[model samples]
Target: MDRTILKSQLERYRTPYEEESAFIDSFIDLTSDPLAYKRERLEGHFTASAWIVNRRRTHTLLTLHRKLGRWLQLGGHADGDENLIEVAMKEAKEESGLTSLDLVDSTIFDLDKHIIPERPHVPEHYHFDVRYILEADINEPLHISDESISLAWITFDSVVDMIGYNPSILRMLEKTSKSEILL
Candidate 1:
C-alpha cells in the first residue's frame, strides 16, 4: 500500500473505544494480516502502541519492560481483538492503569518493522508494525504490573539519556522528538 493510503486507513480509528467490535478486521487490514507478525492476536505482538501523554505537559509515559530490558512506550500485540485503537487503549490501560486517556487520531510513530531478540518460548525475527497513539489526561498514578519492572512518564529527551536504552529505543526517541509522527 502507498504510505499515504496506509496512514489514512490507519487514521480511521480515531475513537477505538466507540467502534470496538470491528477492531480485529481493521487490525488485519492495517497489518496486512495479524498472524504474519509475532504472537497471536490475543497475545498482541503485531506492535500497535497505546500511549498516554501528560495532559499538562505532553510528555509521554514509558514502561521498563522487565523481560525486554528496554524503555518503551506501552503497547503489545492485537491479542484476539484487532481494532488497532482498542489494542492501543487496552495496552495503555493495562500497562499504566490510566483510564482517562484519549487516543490521538494520528500516530506519533510508524516503525512498521523491527526484530526482537530471542526469548524463552518466543523466537527471534519477530516483526512488528509499531503504531503510536498520543494520549491526553495522563495524570493518574501508575500501578505497575508484571509486564514492567518499573514505569515512568518523562520528557523524551530525558528517556534518551537512560543507560539501558538500545539503539532502537533511542531512534524512537529521536523520531518522537522530531515530531515525525504525532505529538
Candidate 2:
C-alpha cells in the first residue's frame, strides 16, 4: 500500500470537529508504519467507507451491519489496498449489490475513528475509516449481502430519528447536509 496517497489526502483534508481533526493527524502518523494498512495491525487499521447517496442526493444508503448490528454506511476493511477510492467503491458495490455507482469526487469526504467491540475470534480494535461520497441510481435494484441484516435508503431528513443512530454517522450527515455539491 502506498502510504503517500493516504498521507497526502490527510494533509489536505479539513474537518470542523476537533476530534476528527485529531483523527486526521493520527492517520498521518500511521503513514510511517508499513503495517498500518493491514488488518493484522491489531492496534488499529485503515478502513474505507462510502457515503452512498442517490442521483438526487436526497437519501443515503445504509446497511444494518451484521457484525456491528447497526444501520451504518457501506464500507469494509481496506486490507492493504492503498487506493482508498477503489476500496470504498468496492465495498459499496459488494455491500449494496449496486453495479452502477459513481464516485462524486476523488477527494476525501469524511474521516472517522471508531472502536470495534471484541468478537468471539476478533479482538477489540479501532477502525480509522476514510470515507468518500458516491452516487447511485435510486431506481436500481439492491440486494442485501450477508454482511447486512437489511438495507435501506434512508432520507437525509429522517436519519436523525432512526434507531441505532451513530454519532460518527451523524457527523457525516452534518457534513453531507452542508455540502453544496451533495445537496
Candidate 3:
C-alpha cells in the first residue's frame, strides 16, 4: 500500500489515452503528500473501482449509483487503504453482494480523474480512481446495496448506449478486450 509502490505501478502502465497517461503523472506528483488517501485531505483522494465483467466476458456489472443516479462501476473512497486492488475488490463485493470474484489481472485496468460535485458538508473535489478488473459468474445473484438504486449487467456492445459512455470506461473496455485475447 505504499505510495512509492503505487507510483511505480502507474509509471509502468502503458495506455493509448494521453489524458490518462497525464493523470498517472499527476497522481505520481500527488504521492509526495502522505495523506493523499484521506477523504478529508480535500486536494484529491484515491478512489478504487472494479471493472467487473462476467465469466464469459460478454457483459459488465454496473450499478445505478444512488447519489449520482448514473450507471457506473462499483467503487468508493480508498478510506486509508493504499492497496487499491483490495479497495476495488472490497467495494465491488460490498456494493454488488457478490461473494465470489477473481481478479482478471493484478495490474490496473484503468485510471480516471473526475470532479465530484459538492454534496452536503463536503466541498467539490477530484477523485483519482484506480480501476481493476474482476470476473464473476453471470448467473450469480446480485443483492443491491443502499448505495445503488439498482444493478444491471450490461452487454459490451450496449454499454456506450446505456450509460452515455465515458471515454475512461471505453478505455477500460478496450484494455479488457485486449487482455481477453491474450488469455
List the candidate 1 regions with Cα displacement exceeding 4 Å.
Answer: 1-34, 37-45, 106-108, 163-183
Tell me the tens digit of each residue's lDDT in model 2 across 67-152. 88788999998888888899999999999899879999888899898899998878999998989999999888999999999999
Residue-wise lDDT of candidate 3 within 1-183, one digit each (tens)? 677788888879887788788778888877777888889789789999999998888999999999988989999998898889999999999999998789877877888999989999999999999998899888989999999999999999999998896888888777777775426
Clashes of each: 13, 0, 0
Mark the regions of model 3 whose C-alpha exceeds 4 Å error after superposition: 180-182
Worst 10 residues of 1 by lDDT: 13-22
Comparing candidate 1 with candidate 3, which one achieves the higher TM-score?
3
Error of 2 at 120 (Å): 1.8
Q: Could you tell me the lDDT of residue 62 within candidate 2?
A: 90
TM-score of each: 0.68, 0.95, 0.95
Model 3 residue 13 CA deviation in Å: 1.5
Candidate 2 is scored at a TM of: 0.95
Model 1, 32-70: lDDT tens per residue? Answer: 553534464323346577545665544768888988787
Overlapping backbone residue pairs in candidate 1 total: 13
lDDT of each: 0.60, 0.87, 0.88
